[model samples]
Target: MKDKTVAIVGGSSGIGLGVAKQVVAAGGRVFIGGRDAQRLERALAQLGPAADGHSVDSADDASVAAFFAAAPAIDHLFTPGASYALGRFMELDEATARSPMDHKFWGQYRVVRHALPKLDAQGSVVLMAGALGARVGLTGAAYAACNCAIEGLGRALARELAPRRFNTVSPGTIDSELWRERPAALREAAFESFAQGAPLGRVGTVEEVVDAVLFLMGNRFMTGSTLYVDGGYVT
Candidate 1:
């Protein structure tokens, strides 16, 4: 992976940052894109010299196109940004539910559409999904639909890309700020619920998800695969 260029959309935080760190550690150059300029700058600073930051709203086609245009031939592309809207199905508003799909679902699609020509033949694309794609329940209509769509997209891309490798990483409930934002009791209860359901008896870490992404990116032989890093949540 030495000197390889990696572009991560929605990489300013969470799983994306974890992957960026791994890429840099593996001697790869990483460009991270996010909507938050300050956060992107901060992440780039934290990632040190091997990382570059770009401000991009993945939901916007123009922004995504410009971002890919500025990025050099990339050896890997990952988008870990599909998170939005969590409520009971009955309570979900149209805007809340559809926003994630518009931003993350189509956002990832746009990235692939624009970046495919810029990828090396051996390059890989890792799309982020979650156990929700397969497990069902808990997450409301929005997340369920979005994750399932992501998995479907991964399958299609893998088939179309053929030797180029396209795969999906489905992580379980990970310990990230996204969860921490919830009320303390809710967060604790959620974690406990996940711990009980998973055969591994615990939630996942950012690093664990990152490891899966790295494996997918490096394993030239793997494609059209949906890897569950969910500790048996879907099982």
Candidate 2:
């Protein structure tokens, strides 16, 4: 990846930050766009000299256009922003139900629309979804639907985008900030329960899922495909 240029949306923390670290380690130049400028600044500092940070809100048209307009044509694009929304089908308010669509689904819609023209011919794109999209749980209809929509979009885009490969990655039960809100004991118990259920006996790490992203980045032949980086949670 030396000298290669990559752009990552929502790259301030979690899996995005992990990708930034890997990009720096591999001697690649990475530019990450995040909604939070302070967080982005911290992330870029952590990533050292090879990484750059930009503030981009994928939901707003002007912001999206400006981001791609100012961004250099790149070898790869990664859109990893996901909105938080979950509720039972009957109880979900219209606004709550549409939150994921507004951010997670349509946000990528905005990113991909602008990124296409700016992408290098050999460039690839990796869209991050979730395992819940492949299989369902007892709740979170909106979240699951948004994730499913992302995979669908990636498949269609792979064909439409042609040689610029597009793929979706579905990560299951990752150990991330999503669990940080729980009390330590509760969090530990939750993780253990998840581990007991998965055949692999544990949840995934950010490193594991980021490895999948890099694989898609490097593998030119893969497109219109979904890589499930779950710990056997969906299988």
**What's each prediction's clash count?**
0, 0
Q: All candidates' lDDT scores?
A: 0.86, 0.85
Off by over 4 Å in 1: none
Give residue 165's lDDT in candidate 2 (0 to 100): 93
Candidate 2 achieves a global lDDT of: 0.85
User: Clashing residue pairs, candidate 2?
Assistant: none
Which segments of model 2 are wrong by more than 4 Å?
181-190
Which 10 residues in a row give candidate 1 its minimum summed lDDT? 81-90
lDDT by residue (tens digit), candidate 1, 8-126: 99888889998998889888999889898998998999899999877888778899888888887898999876557677777888888787688778888988998888898888899
